[model samples]
Each structure stands twice: as C-alpha cells, then as structure tokens.
Target chain A: MPERAEWIAVDWGTSALRIWAMRGSEVLAETRGSEGMGQLAPEDYEAVLLRHAERYLAGDRVTEVLVCGMAGARTGWREAPYRAVPCTPAGEGAVKVPVRDERLKVRILPGLSQARPVDVMRGEETQIAGFLAGRPRFDGVICLPGTHTKWVQISAGEVVSFRTFMTGELFALLAGQSVLRLSVASDGHDADAFRDAVGDAISRPESLGAALFSLRAGSLLEGLDPVVARARLSGLLIGLELAGARPWWLGAEVVLIGSAAVAEPYREALAAQGLAAELVSGERMALAGLIAAREVMA
Target chain B: MPERAEWIAVDWGTSALRIWAMRGSEVLAETRGSEGMGQLAPEDYEAVLLRHAERYLAGDRVTEVLVCGMAGARTGWREAPYRAVPCTPAGEGAVKVPVRDERLKVRILPGLSQARPVDVMRGEETQIAGFLAGRPRFDGVICLPGTHTKWVQISAGEVVSFRTFMTGELFALLAGQSVLRLSVASDGHDADAFRDAVGDAISRPESLGAALFSLRAGSLLEGLDPVVARARLSGLLIGLELAGARPWWLGAEVVLIGSAAVAEPYREALAAQGLAAELVSGERMALAGLIAAREVMA
Candidate 1:
C-alpha cells in the first residue's frame, strides 16, 4: 500500500519523542513513546530512539526516518554541521546518519549558525520552518520563549537574524533557587510591578546594569516587602528582555510560539510593550516541522 | 583616667569582632572577640555585643557604646534609618540609634541612601569614612569591594555620590551554587578569559542584557569548557561593574578598601581598565572609623 510508507517524521524534543506517519498533508497515524533526549544516556541514544520507533512503526515497513531537535547535536545520536545564517527550511543541511542498519535511512536536521562572535541553534530552525510553512507570507518578528527566549526575525520565508535572551532561565533561577527565592511570594503575575519594571527597562535600558541591585537593596533599604521584591525582580528581568529585543521588533508584527507555560508571560510582556502578538502552539509547530522536513526529503 | 572607660566600640562584621576602648584617638586598650554578627541571634544582639564589650570593658565604668557594620542593620541589633546621599561622616540626619540604656549613648552609624529611584548602603559608609580618615587630603574615587562592591567618589572629605554592585554576591552565586558551578575548574584567575570578558563588557556594556546567554550557548553550541565558562561569567560580571561605575570614576583616583580576600580581583579589574588603584585594609578602616567617631563624640 502506497509502495510501503515512504517516511516517518519524528519530533524528539527536550520533553518527549513524538512520531507522525503521513503521505502529503494527510496523516496516516500518530504515536508517541517515552524516549526524551534529556533522559537518555549518551551511548543508549540509538537504542532509545529505535525502540520508540518500533512502537510507532508497528511492524509496518518505513523507508526513511527524519529527526528534529536535540537529537542531532553533540549530545544527541550524532553531530551534524550547523548551517550558517541567512538560512531557509529548504536550504538547510541534512545529516544522513546510519543507525543499526543502512536500510533505516535516518536524517537529522542541521541547526542554524551565526559566524562573527559564533552562536548556533539546532532545534529552533525546525520550529521556524514550521511557522513559515503554515504562514508563508508572514514577515515579522517571532518569539520562542523557553529556558532561552529566542527573538527571531523572519522576512519572505527566511530567518533574517535573531537574538536570544536568558529570560526563562533567569526566571527559573530567581524564582526556584536564587537569592530572590526568599522574596518571591507567588508564581502569578504582579501586573503593577511588571508594568513598572517594563517601563524602567525601556526608559533606562542602560541602568539595567545597576538596576539588578534593587532586588537586595529593596529589601535592605526601603523595606521592599519580600513578595513585592520578588515581583520587581521578575519585572526587572522581563523588562531587560523587552529592552534588548526592542530593536529587532521595530514596526513588526509579533508572533509567539511556545507552550502556554512559557508563552503567557512573553505575551503579557509584548502586550505591555503595546505590541499585538499572535500565539501559535509550539507542539503543533514541532509536528508541522517534522512533516515539512519529510516532504523536503521526499 | 577620663572618669573610667566610658564606652567600647564594637566592630562586628562577617568574620570577626574587634572591640576598642578609647577616650578619643588615645586607645586605652583593645580586645578580640570570637563573636561575629553573622553568628549572633536577633534577640542575642545586646547580650552578644555586651559579652564582647564586657571582655574589653572588664568592670571599667562603661557608659555609652558606638557600633558599626552588620550590628546597626536589621540583621544586626536594630534597624537604623539609612542616611540619604550627598552625605558626609559628620553630616546631620544620620540615624543616631538608642540601644538598651539611654545614657548608654549608643550611636550606630547611619547607612547611606540615594533618593528618587532609591538605593542604599550600610557598612560601606564606615569604610568610606575610614578611607577618608586615613587620608583626609585624598579626594577622588574610593572603592570598597566585597559581597557588595561600593564605588564612591569623594570631594573635600564628603561622600559626593556612590554606587553599589553585587559583584561578590554574583561570584558566590555563580561559582559556589549556580548552574555554572559545574564549569568552575579553578578558584584562581584565568587571565586570558578574564581579559576577553573585560573587553567584551567594556565594548558592549549594553549587551550585558544579552551577554549572560553566552554561558549556556558557549557550553551548548561551541563546546565551551565549563571552567572557562565560569571564569568568563566572573569576567562579564566584573566587567559590567566596571562599566556601570565608569561614569563615577572618570578622572578620579581610585582607592580600593577591603581585605585582600575581596580587593584583589577588583584591583585586577581596575588595572585592566588602565586605572591605578591603591589598596586599603577594610579592618584598618573599620578601626579608623571607630576611632574617628570616638574622637568626634569626645
């Protein structure tokens, strides 16, 4: 039937491994298995991926396997060369990796790179491609907020450039374990403090270098209620992100892609900046990217 | 002999407490105490200070006491009002806190403050006064680097203005407990990486908003050795401090007052900026400030 299912697209991310079998836009079947890259031992990577693949294959013959996300980097099954900037979905490099058998025909997506001063991203390119695939004519700013919040600019279906801010990580650190933990009262947004911090970040972006001291000073000097100090810290961090990403977003439609857990704050931040943003499901994009990669190879 | 020793000056800080008995610059006697502010309980403050003071007072007619450093703040004996900026050691409005007995004449030094977009300093002022006391004719930049680094500019023995940096705290967090802990290979300086980060900080002080991302990106993408990453983080932090204080330090003689434990790296950082810095002992300053206060009261 259909000359033996041509390919299977796998979106293996930090959290889970998901597979979709499809011919064209129509899906044949979708399955998932527990083989997240984060938990696997470096040596057990192939076994984990293949074992997960077996559950999805269901004894059906599949000719090719396409992998996206952290599965192809140094810690992944194999190292793939990063494609330099000015990259597109169609123009990106693919690494054909040999698993247990040559007949398996596995290809991992390559990441995008920035040369001068050197930076690179592996899993994000696929997400960008998926975004472009769904909205081909979209030309604006796209924000993927996660442990590392990436602000990418897309124009005419190509990633022009991007900058990443450590918003999510800093949030985790400050809220979960850092010195600010003693002060952070709740996870919920403190709207008033957030707005104040955002204004502060934008108005005195340079002061951010000094503004951080406020976290401790607030408590030490003004008797900044510990809870309010927490909120202010959050605001200061997010405000900094807004300030840094402001130049990239000049007069551009803002699009946010990530789990609600990650996207909501970013949306709020963008809204605070007086920018309207369209939310897209990050999981769906991961799937869409896998599908797009399959079609490219086909 | 001066109607018996009237009071004892207790300098209780992070590490140790040194008690001084004086009827002005003429030191009657001094004694070392095992008690430190960090080790004492909130309720035990009076007992603790008295316990140490008792060793030095030794049945002498003690009437009043003057305390500085951690003892004057909340964590210390009592919460004192932070004296706002443009303040001098001799200026009025500095908090004169009363302890246990009114005639005890206990006057804890008032911490400095910055109004409008508030910032404050506690123990650093004493160090500033100590620095000025030692070299009253000296007028320029005086830096007291430690868990909180204070870069202060002085004119005619007055603290014109100053800024506080969390350099020591950041170092402790990053090297001792943060995610970068895994990357910290050497406790000593990595001169090459430190210089690179210093230059990076100076050249793009604004990028500090984004520069932190390099810690993760360096490890993830370019295979940045963790140890180097740790050093780089330290460098970036110190570099940012240098940049933030640059405006205050313009055309000023920089005097670093803190123990070798805290001042060495700051000295290196200053020298990197082509600024000549003279090292002053924080211990000596504390003693000097206590002596100066005793003299003024006399």
Candidate 2:
C-alpha cells in the first residue's frame, strides 16, 4: 500500500492552487491546478482540494491540511480574519474550516494587515512567517515582489508595518495594453537600458507619466529597439516602486522573497543604489511557513 | 439649390471623424462619424470623409478639405510630418494627400514635436493655433486635457516646448480595468475626495503606487465608498500630473482648452493649488485653427 500522508500543505493564490502531501516536515507528494481561489466558489474549495489529495489520504484516519494564501481570504473556503500589524507573522490565529469530507481537517492561516497605510497580505504572511522561522534574529525590511509588491517591516519577529505597490500590475498593463505595446517586445531584456531607466526614475519619479509616453514617441521617431523598450518599461516601474519604497529599504537590511525572475530585477535596481539585499526562494518560504502553522495546530 | 461649402474643416481624431461644412467661417452644416482614424486604413480615409462631406461638394469645382489630428499620422491618409518645436503651432507645413476623387483636395496640418523630452501632438496643435489666433500676444502655458494631457509653453506666438502625460489613460485603465475597478464606481465624482487625493498625490508623488493600492485595501477594510474611490483615483492621477507639470503651470499664465466635461476636473484640481485657469471650448479652438490654416493655404 502507498504511504498515507500525515498532513497537507497548501498554497492557494489568485491564479493557481498548489498542495503538497506532507509526512511531518517532509513533502511526500505535490500537485497543483489552475482552480485557484479566485475562480472557485467557497463551496468548491473542498472538492478541489480532495481531487489532488485523495491518493495520499487513508480512509481509516483524518489528515490535517494546513492552508495559506488566498484560501483564507474572505471569498475563499472560510474567511480567516486578518491579524492587524504589530503581530507575529503566521502565529496561532489559524481558522478551522468546517469541511464536508470527514477525512480532511483544514485550518487556514490568517494574513497580516496594516491599518495606517491600509495594506493587507493574503498569502505572503505565511511566507514571511517561514522566512522569520529560519532567521528569527533578522530585522529590517522584507520585499515581496509580485502582482502587487509588498514592502514589509519586520522587527522582533513581528510585522511592524507594511505598504503595497501596484508596480507589477502597472508594468503588465502598460507593456501589454497601453500604446507602448506597439513599441515594447513581449519577451527580452536589456540590462543597460534597464539600469538607465531605473536611474532616471529614481532621480525624477514625477516625470514617470511623460517618460512612459516618450517610449511610444521614441519608437516612432527614433526606431527604438523593442527589447530595450521592454527592459526600460520594467525598469521604470520597478524604479518607481523603489523610489516609493525608500522608507522600507534605505540603510535597512533588505531581504527579497520572490522567484529569481522577479526578485533579480529588484536586486539589480537596489544594487545600483548601493544596497545588496539577500534573496530567498518564495516557494520554499511558503512551504516552511505552512509547516510552521501545522506545528502550531498539532 | 443647396449652398456649396466654401471649404470643409475636419478634425479626424482616433475615436471620431468630425467635419464642418463651412462657407467663409460660417458653419453651413456639421457632421461627425465613428469612422475615426484608428479604425480606418490609408485608402479608407477619403471614402469616410466623402461619406460625411459629399453634400458640401460642388459638381464642377473641387472642394478644399482642411484636416487635422491623427489623419496626418504615418498610417493615416498621408504622413504630415511633425514640425519640431520653437515654431508656430499651425503655421505652414501641410501635407496634401493624393486622393482618387478629383472633387477633393485634403491638406493635413503638421503636429508639433519636442526633441529633448521626445514628445508629439497631432490634433491639439490646431486648437493651440486657434487659441493663439485670438490672443496674438498670449504668452504663457496652455493646458490641454484629454486621453493624453498636454502642457504647452507659449511665448512670442510660438510653442516653445510642451510635455504630455498619460494621466487620463492611467485613470481609465486603473478605475475601469485594474483591481480597483471592483472598489471604484464606474461613474461618479466626489469633489472632497478628489481634492484630498490631489493634495496627497501632489505632496507625495512617489507614494502614488502605494496610494493606488490603498484604494483597494480601503474598500476591503473600511467599505470605502465607490464614488469616493473613483474620485480619489482621478485626484491621485491628476495630482500626479499636476506634480509633474508644475514647471509648466507654476508662475505661468495657465489657460485650459478642452470641453467642460473633461476640463472641469483639471480646473478644480488647479484651483486647489491656488491657480485660476481660463477654460475655453475645445471645439471652438479647433475650428478657429482650421480657419487660420485655410487662410494660410489661400
């Protein structure tokens, strides 16, 4: 007989749902699907989870499922209310979800919220928790780059405060849907172009609106290369975020938690300004976070 | 017998093609169609123009049609090359499109271009010319608000320089398409919310990315009113523009050229910044500019 799973670790986000069949702290099996919390109704969450997890389940005993990310959102399986900041990331505030399947005991971890700047994180709290678990002594900023990049302040193992920027979404919309779409390449990068744009934006962010339109004009007037334009667009947005996020990163020990593809650009931009931030794998952090939450449930 | 038009004035923009059947500056008739330059190819421009102005044409004599805007774009009827700045708005350069129909003589006015910052404008130049025609010695800044807002510096009856902002387009993309769409109302304006947001953005332009995301967070956490959110979105974008365009408007005579619907927000935002700008009808300026161009052709 196949080994029965001891517990499950799930990271459910807007676009995808990933679950790992865990035997204690070790992942025995893993699977993911496009049926994310964004698309699924609250009633559909149980079946979706069971579909990927059924093979690892033992009919004789119930298995505890530790869920993180958007699955705990108000629209997800059950609303795991946010723990307002100046609180520990992914502490003991996991909400017990009433599941139709008797074999599954699911608890979703609560996200962190900041009232002043009015910021909230659905899934990154767990990732932050996971990162903090490994480095409890670390203090300073945690930059989580994604669709909505979050700059979180961490001190004494608690989320002191946080702010979010729509840099990624803005970049996607401008390069894909705006007039610049005609000028920018869908895939490619120019490091020099990116660095130049980052410098320009950091120095004078007020000119961002004019600078963006110039890309379209530049393409028409100067025959600007598509690759360079794409890099410049990414650099400008990221640079603007860096400018906005100066309070979080300046003279502070910064750690970037994201895939290398996203985090690398931020790191390069920061390096230009004399900051060498430590980079960590987002997936690993999220899994570690789920493991931490599970230990508390036990 | 129907009164033949002395000359036809046309403003062929991206979304609409507007024409005036004029007899010596007096509008004999006016009509506009949805066949904007955006949806038409080079060959299709003549047919679309004729479909609207055919009634104004004389059988024996050719009808002179003065065209402005994107119809002069490279992909439009014919390429009316941009005249680099430090020149009069609607002065001499007008490209005559070779059309199949002998009854039509179309001359498209050249747009203005700035070299340093790399900016361009098409239809707005005609309006600028018209506005300048009335005030020959008008020396200051002209603020033209549209999908792409233009802040132009006018000195000694010439357009010294200008800057363009994608503020309007940004507002549309964010309020209509971004995640904020769920929080912001599709149609409505809160004056107080707009003023506050404008102030916030002007003071802290770098915080723009964060400020935008807060609208979504505010909606989630505080049930931020949709109308207020919409107004706040507009205020933030416009405030950012005002912040960027400060060099153009600060300590300069500011005249706004746009329809009341589009220009009102700008005037209000500027008013909050202690500037009373003169608002003029956009259509009037375009017609006046077309008249001025026709005189030059004669």
Candidate 3:
C-alpha cells in the first residue's frame, strides 16, 4: 500500500525543478529533477513532470498540479500571464493547462510585474506568498537572494515595489568564466578578507571595476591567497549590492528567504551594516506557498 | 621576385596572431591568423610564426622577430618576465626565444607591473612606447580600452602608475551570455539612452546592479527598445569605470588608443563630463611600438 497524493506542487526555473506531493496543507512526499524549463520544449514539460511524480501517484484519480516560475513564462510549458503589482502573490489568476493524462490537472501561477520602474519575478513570488501566509500582517522588505537577487517591499500584506540585482550571476561569471578565474578557487574563504573587501567596496563603491581586476593583479604580484581572493570577490559584489539596496533595508526589518548558503552572506553583511535580518528557509517557503495556492485552485 | 624580410613584428594574443613583414623599419606585407596563444601549445608557436612570415623568408638568413603580448605569458610560448612599474617601457631586457629555424631570431618584450595596487599590461606597453616615441615630451594619462581597459599615468617617459577595468568584458558577458541577452541587440544603440545611463551611473554609482536588471524589466514592461538596452548597458559599465578612474583623467589631458568602435563611447562619456579626449589608432601604435622595440633589439 502506498500513500495517495491529493495534489502536486512544483517550483521550476531555468536549470532545475522541484515537486512536492501535498495532502491538503501538508506535504506527504518531496522530489525534484534537472529537467528545468530551459531544456524543455512546450510538449516536453508534461512528460518530465509526470515522470518525476509517478512514484507519488497512488491511483487513477486526478492529481491537482500547481506550478510557479518559468513554467508560466511565455517560452515555458504554457503561458500564464503576469499579475500586476500591488496584488497578493497567489494562484487565483493561474491558467489551466490541458494534459494528456487525466490523472494530472495543472495550473501555472502568474508572476508579478511593476510598470513604472520596470521589475518582474516568477518563482520567488511563491516564496513571498508562503512567507506572508505565516505572517499575514508582516509589513517590510523581503530579500530573496539567488542568481538574480530580488528585494521586494511589502506594505499591509501586499507587494508595493521591488528591485532585482545580478549579484550572484555576476560573481559566477567573474569567478568561473572571467580573467579572475585563475586567481579564485571554487570554495574556502577568509573571513577577514571578506570583511575588508566589504568595507572597501561599501565605502568607495566607485572602485568596484578596478577592484575586480586587482584580484588577478594581487595574485600575480603579492601572492594573495586563493581563498582570500574568492572571499574578496564575493564580498565586493555583495557589498556593492548592499550599497545599492540601502534604501530598501536601511532602517527596516527584513526577512531573508533563501537557502542557508546564499542567505547567510546577506545576513552577515546586514549585521556588519548594523541591521537585523530574519531568516526563512527558501525550500520550506516554496512548499508552503505551493500548499496555500492549492487550497485556492484545487 | 619575392620580397626580403629584414625584420618581423608579431602580436600574439589569447585569440589571434598578427605579424607584419618589415624591411628595415618599413612594413612590406602584413598577415594574421587565428592561431592565438589559447589555441596553441608551447611548441606550436614557432610553426605559426614561420608559416605566417614564410613569404617574407629571405635566403634562410636570420629573420629578427620582435613579439608583444600574451605569447610571453607563463602559459604562452616562453615566459618573458614582467618589468616592475615606475620604469620606462623598453625592449632592452627582452627574453630571446630559441627557435628551430635559424631564419627566425625572436625576442619577446617584457610587460610592465606595479606592486602596490597590483597591475600588469603586456601588449599595451608597446602602444605606450609608440605613443611616447612620436610625442616624446607628451606627459599625461594614456587610456587603452579593450577586454581589459588600462588607465596609465605617464610622468616623463615611464609608465608611473596604472589600473585595469573589466568594463568591456562585462559588457560582452551581460549582453551576450546573461539573461539580459534576450533584451539586447548585437550592433545597434540609442545615443540618448546611452548618455542618460552614463550620467545616471556616474552620479549614482551605487545603483549599477539594480539598473542592469531594469533593462530586462523595461523590455518586459514598457517595450524598451533592444538597441537602447544595449546602449544603456555599455554606458553604465563605461561610466562606472570612469567614476573609478576619475583621478587618472579628470582635468588632465587624456589619450585614447583603440579602434573607433571601442573608443567612441568613452569619448562621448568623457565629453559629457567636460573632458576633451584625443584618439589614437591602436594598430599604428602597435606597429610604432614594435619599430621602437626593434630599433633597440636589432
């Protein structure tokens, strides 16, 4: 005998996919795959989703599927239109997709968009919803860090305005692909070096570009440690982001929603800047957000 | 009758090899190939030089070869150690590479390096030499923009100090490899958008990361033109470089060495800040630099 899955929840992005077998507001089982939206054709998405969720399926009964992120993008499985800003992050406006398997009924949730300053986010909105569900009266900024780190303002339980930065992506390119690659290692960092770099960039944000090349120069001339080099690179980019995002988090209570590894730096950097940031697990928030959406759409 | 080769000038970079056939100080014929340092082995560099200059080979007599750039890097043909900063850019101490063909007598010129801020430049030293030889008394800043844009301070005839920026490389990655690629065109620009972006970054350098993402959001929300997005991207990076390099060129005579395409935006941006810039052709500078090096080495 196997546990029956009442519904399915998915968070899909450019590189990977994660799914949860939900029984009402509770998750019964969890799984994910590398068959992300980027590698899938419109017709290929259904098969990947179904294959990954097969083990959780108990019978021929229909499994309500709720998805957020790139699956709703225009180039993804099916186009789920965006819900404009100043609105709740939910599955209310989710668009249904016809599936070959009668056991699968899917709805892709819409992302959020701002018109004036021009900003958008997909899967992170689901985490925002989950964070809001646990604290409905929460009114502050939600800093969601990833490849494209997003800083969103919430007032009276609705998203007011938001901005995104390419900090993580920039670090990846500089460390792994740029000329700085030879000077930096994949892991290990010096805390003192990270702190010094943070202070340097934050104090003089103008020197960011020159400081980047200095990593290579430092390695060549002064025998700078590779660990310190990696740490300094991370510190510089994050410090630059902190300098830019000061307006959003200056005197405000912030909730950081992301993995421990990614969120830790923001927390440390904020602390270094004299701010307290509350932490939330990105995975759990995604799950909670999906379960909440299922209650409205299923 | 075939032309005789009295000398050879070669620029071996990471991606391309260019050589000029010279009779005394005048170039007789010039040829280049895609056999860059990144694509060839240590032993493969000699064959490339010989084959490209085969037409200029005369009576098996020793053909004096003067080379610049990455061919002398540790990973290149044979490492020609770098000369410390606050020194004249000369070929007097260039390392001679032993070759199989007696017809090819090669000496790879040493690059310049600084200890404190940690900076180095290989091929650009030759350009600096060329510029100085033509205008021996000119004293100011020499800015060479490319994948790694270099800003050098020349007091008298020596490269006193310098800094390098990853601006051009960042533009290439963001415009071609990052998510911003979807919203940017290859070879088009909006000058007005470019100027506005430059002013924005120059005045508020901290907002660079956020402003980068705005390009994508603008496309998604306001139908921002791809050409405008491309221009804005270039302007932002260059403006950021200028902000960091203010000490080098502000209120001082500046010389820009590069192609029209690469130097155009820098020129415009400098003009925006009330700084007039004199442009120099990079190819001619390289040839002149080689000629200067040959006069010493030959």
Top lDDT: which candidate number? 2
In order of appearance, the predictions have TM-scores of 0.77, 0.97, 0.97
Show where candidate 3 strays beyond 4 Å. Answer: A58-60, A296-298
A1-298 in candidate 1: lDDT tens per residue?
Answer: 3223456777776667877775566667677877777676657766775665554443544467788877877777777777777768542578887667444677888877775545567687888888888899998888888877788878888887777776666666656665456556655657787778777866655555467676667666566776666667777777777876778765789899889867876778778888878889887887788777667665
Clash-forming residue pairs, model 3 = B63-B103
Per-residue CA lDDT of model 3 for A177-286, tens digit only, reads 88889999999967778878888888888899899999998887788899999999999999999999999999998999999999988888888888989999999998
Predictions' DockQ, in order: 0.31, 0.78, 0.83
**Distance from true location, Cα of A215 in model 3, Å:** 0.8
lDDT of 3: 0.89
Worst 10 residues of 2 chain B by lDDT: B289-298
**What DockQ would you assign to candidate 1?**
0.31
Classify candidate 2 by CAPRI docking class.
medium
lDDT of 2 by residue, A1-298 (tens): 5568999889999889888988888988888889988799999999998888888899999998888999888888899999999888885788999998999998889887888978888899999989998998888999999999999999999889999999988998898888889999999899999999999988888888998999988888888999999999999889888888998999999999999998999999999999999999999999999888777566
> Model 1's CAPRI class?
acceptable
Total clashing pairs in model 2: 0
lDDT of 1: 0.71
